[model samples]
Target chain A: MNLAKTALITLCLMGTTGLVHATDPNLARNLAATCANCHGTNGKSLGGIESLAGEPKQKLLQKLADYRSGEKPASVMHQIARGYTDEQLDLITTYFAAQK
Target chain B: MQNRRDFLKTAGIAAAGSSVFGIAGCAGMGKGSGGHVVVVGGGYGGATVAKYLRMWSEGQIRVTLIERNTAFVSCPVSNLVIGGLKTMADITMSYDNLKSRWGVTVITDEVRALDTAKRTLTTTNNGTITYDHVVLSPGIDFMTDSVGGLSGNEALVPHAWKAGPQTVILRTQLESMKDGGIFAIHIPKAPYRCPPGPYERACLVANYLRQAKPKSKVLVLDANGEIQSKKALFTKAFESYKGLIEYRPNNELRSVDAKTRTAELDFDKVKADVLNVIPPMRAGDIAARSGLPLINDRWVDVDWITYEAKGVPGVHVIGDALFPAPTMPKSGHMANQQGKVVAAAIINLLAGEAPNASPVVMNTCYSFVDGKNAMHVASVHQYDAIKKQPMPVAAAGGVSPAANEIEGKFAHAWAQNIWADMLA
Candidate 1:
């Protein structure tokens, strides 16, 4: 069997379609919903807080990485950034960066 | 803006659920590859899971939310309504959108029993429903025994913590109070729902009495040694109300004389025309009755990563029903995040993947100092696998430098958007 066909069957058997990303929006949305409590809805903040959306992917990723380390000074991002794996952070940053 | 609806629509993942349910010709509708998840008590946690489970699964895995009430009345900004700042309708939300837009089966009924062995739930309205996974978000119930003479007479001195009829009763009493009358509120200790809530209530009550009946005064009796949250902000707010407000910490309530409106405290006795006593709280009744192992026989004990009740594979507990760790506050925001966290874990397990262990939860509690002015305390907590508790990251949390109207606007937006996320 072809690799594409095997992947398609696996995806179909997993209860999702290829149209949705492997890291689906449901996961992204649920994960991102935590952000809405402070950063407005969907990564956008209305107050003086910096908007997480519409940032460059690399820039966002770098900022989060900085937060994960002791390099950044933050009220809560340091703790928040520590919660995700690098790949998960990649998915999150990509999710928000594409959010314009 | 990439709203949730836009995300679902773009993903072509059962965006408009109306056609999927009422009409036919939809794709696989049974249980999908992922099994069904039954959620009880559609508050902040249950509602979020019910909606997100379907959303992330693309309407594959079925979700049934059993709640006793038809509508959700949020306790987040409920103090405003008690002080006559906002109406009950302002904080009320319905599950209409959860059903119509998200394809969740919301049953308006009380869950009577959870037969974990059979994996079925016996509810008042619905006979019995089986499930693959069950999430319980029963919220808090008062420990009336902690305060004497509180068990039978709830109406006389309303708790008003649950944010509905009691809130109305308190408001009514406050309005009927004569000028120069004393309006007293007794706050429970830490580990209660909304740590900043009582202090915020004191602020609003003081604000109200100062404005409407300048002769009247508010006496805040707190059980804890100091303010549970946002100490600086609340202390400053209390100073703003000066003589109109008097705060006494460590004045634990011993008993109450409902008729005389007197509260017998450890140090002194307080008499008032209006009494709003927030009794000590424990896990909701169902959490105790579900036969789930509870910490100290009060709050449910669960694995921080999965929120699954300890020793019970399929049963998960979230919201204020779970025992609070030192770092975690029982706020609606944290409950909502726990809903998502538990959902994410369940979804992963359903997909035959490992659950996300390192879960990060954030809480932003906005307290309205008055009708328009507000203050906030924000924190980020992560599950520690070693310690098996949620811990705050170093220097990762802070309170607003001062209470202002800008945060008030954010508070409104936060409530609207969170309601939309959970219900809409």
Candidate 2:
């Protein structure tokens, strides 16, 4: 094949793989539901509440652990996180990270 | 700017299958391309080092973290879980994130031995794995023998500091005690993991009993004359609970008779239904067995500037294992900061570049005095190259106000931000 045609084919292949690897929507929805109470809808919160939307997932999990440990004080979030499991934290983090 | 360009160039070549340039760049930057880094004990420091090394190097380094369990149940927040304010599920984390996301090889096995000369680490299950670099962050090993009669028999006198089944056992014992039963918490002198940890435990446990077992009392037996950090603040908060909590200082626990549920303190023998004895500690067994030099009865010695082991070449120690500064209490916050600093040093060493010999490290410790009242201490320090030690940096950070609404809010925000920095 000609060089241009070969390059075009490679570009198309890359796009398809990129689309497949994009964030998962189902995961994002689950996280939104889990975090909505304190973090507000879509992780954007009201006054004094921190936004979790677009934040790194590792940071989210660590913050939750800190709150539960009293290393980080929480008025309500601590109680909220106390109800989550490790699997649930992963699901929540993945879901929120995928949100806009 | 030149260094960034050079790094990008090296990374670009490495990505394009130029193995020679990759090795040359890594070596030039004081890092290794293909050699493995096996970290024993995957807690805050180890996990931070492993994650950052993988992230900052962009998969160039093969990092293997050997932990005894797949999940890390953080001791920082386990108290909340015990107080019924948080659940066990909240404090637990999986190495799966570190493994799958960060490309670190997670070996869920206990480290058995370390051959520093051979550069080999043997695990209980994985046998032996050699490394070009080894990061030991095994944390503290409790010395039950320091508490006299409590030695060897942990079941009778439990120290729930490790945050596992022992934590649950301590919780169960507390739950089973009589409504007005006495709960005795013994605090170690100094150089323990999380200096504010014991006080926080006392507050949370007292908070729990005030509601669940109103008649029960919590007597804190402190080794030091005063509570280590934020003493006055915690003392005042305890008064709000009235008879539920009592603070006793200068009461060093000399021995304990578990059968009689009696503890012999410096002043007298006290009988209690529950005994929580936190003994003196040292670095993990691997550090001692490896023959690494220690400072002030601790783990491998490292120059504060570069975090390189003083006597040992090519070996670096970070976290609770190292005796950096006497005033700096061992906390996850400090360990995470040290991890980044050590990671930078490792990268520099591999590239044949001088590490940032003088890096600033920050530490923030939060202690929840009661359900709502919380106190904090945050500080920044710089390594004095000539002095070979760490000194507090001027005007960087300060402790949380003893009691104020604004300070309370700030402490809460600090916790969120710090956790985000570490895990996220």
Candidate 3:
């Protein structure tokens, strides 16, 4: 990555971490809730879609990372994964991982 | 300890100021106490916000959803019903789950007036309701007056946009059309509800006609220059129907003859056996009458992060009602995402806490090109702190390579999942 692009990503990571701890405690849960429309409530999908509930945090993070990197092609997830910062993705996966 | 009076006082003071983005102090309720929230119009946006508020608050916040319709009728899969592939039951769902399971108080009444300063809403049937915050998600309403001779003739040329009785009416009209008859559907200008919806309807209708009435032709009289969404895919889908589908660009509906079933454009006038005109639209009537600031005198102007109306304090508007950000389509998926953002904001604001600094929302819309084949357009938008709006992520989000049956199944699954996400 170029220096500017790398610097931008680093700044985003620092900003995300700072905001999550300083502002809303429910930030992770709120971010995860945005996925409920297609994925189901708390990531326990109803049917026809993969459920994210109870998945290991590392596994979920790896899947999201792959999607962001375009390594694991998806119909929608690839696009969605690129929308979040790395810290935001970590929080979302952690939230879903805790869900039963 | 703050009481209900103190809470109202703080809200009123905050609302009266130049900015009402943040209200001060928690309304000091005891250990198990929370405030009440009133949601207007139990559609995709309204229902999702109501359920999320109740769930996140853990029953501390009381939620009352006031909607005119008794049950939830979805617009996503309603096109399949128009094409005769699905029934109304398939697109219809009950709001009982929101009541019984999510603990939302569903009131089947229309909101007549809103007092932003008093933080109260008056319904047509029920008495006035006071709330700590109010959310309006009334969707879009047609500007029938814009099209001459079309104001009171909706029964003759049904829009079927809201997906209830009008859907059934249009379906019945299609069913009664002769084998060789021409069914014409009109498309309004850009920035209408569901960017790809009109084209999908044309495809489904043509799909039905190709099988049942081979001699019949489908005319798509579009006001815009080209297809608004998934252009290449829809263009390819239209080619599959061959001579059965005719697409006309910039042929806006200036007027209509309801009696003769004729559409009057600037250059030509065409008559059809079944005339379907999707008229120009604005924010729902309730949003217009609530004294909220509107953009282009149509859509409500709202803050991207909180979905809060620009000038109205403690009143957030979502769904098709709000003037969308750059490249944001007025879609149910986006509305539900906005609903979640607003839900989270309201919860924090009610507790005298700051709302989340960075929020994310995305859209995934699947449109069926035929009975068993579908295509999709997906986009992801993140809150841009510099622009103060959600901008589309570069090098991300795109349309499907081609129409396929895999996405067809995913389309049906999308409808079922989204309906449950809002109501259930």
Worst 10 residues of 2 chain A by lDDT: A16-25
Residue B243 of model 1, lDDT score: 91
Candidate 3 residue B281 Cα shift, in angstroms, is: 0.2
> lDDT for each of the candidates?
0.78, 0.69, 0.85
Best by DockQ: 3
Off by over 4 Å in 3: A1-23, B1-33
Put down candidate 2 lDDT per residue, B317-380, tens digits, no spaces.
7888887574666887777777777665565455434455445565656677656666666665
RMSD of each: 7.5, 11.5, 7.8
Arrange candidates by lDDT, highest first: which order?
A: 3, 1, 2
Residue-level lDDT of model 1, residues B1-424, one tens digit each, is 2333333232234323334321121122212355789999888888988987887677877899998888999998888888889899998888998899899998999988999999999988789999989999999999998899888888999999997888889999999999999989999877788889998998888878888999999999999999888898899999999998899999999999988889999989988899899999889998888789888878889888789988998899999998876678898888888998887777766654446656778777889899888877777786677898888765566677788787788788778767766777
What order do you get sorting by TM-score, best first? 3, 1, 2
Query: Which model is ahead, 2 or 3, in terms of lDDT?
Result: 3
| Model 1 bad stretches (over 4 Å) | A1-30, A38-90, B1-32
DockQ of each: 0.21, 0.03, 0.23
Candidate 3 chain A worst ten-residue window by lDDT: A9-18
lDDT of 3 at B29: 15
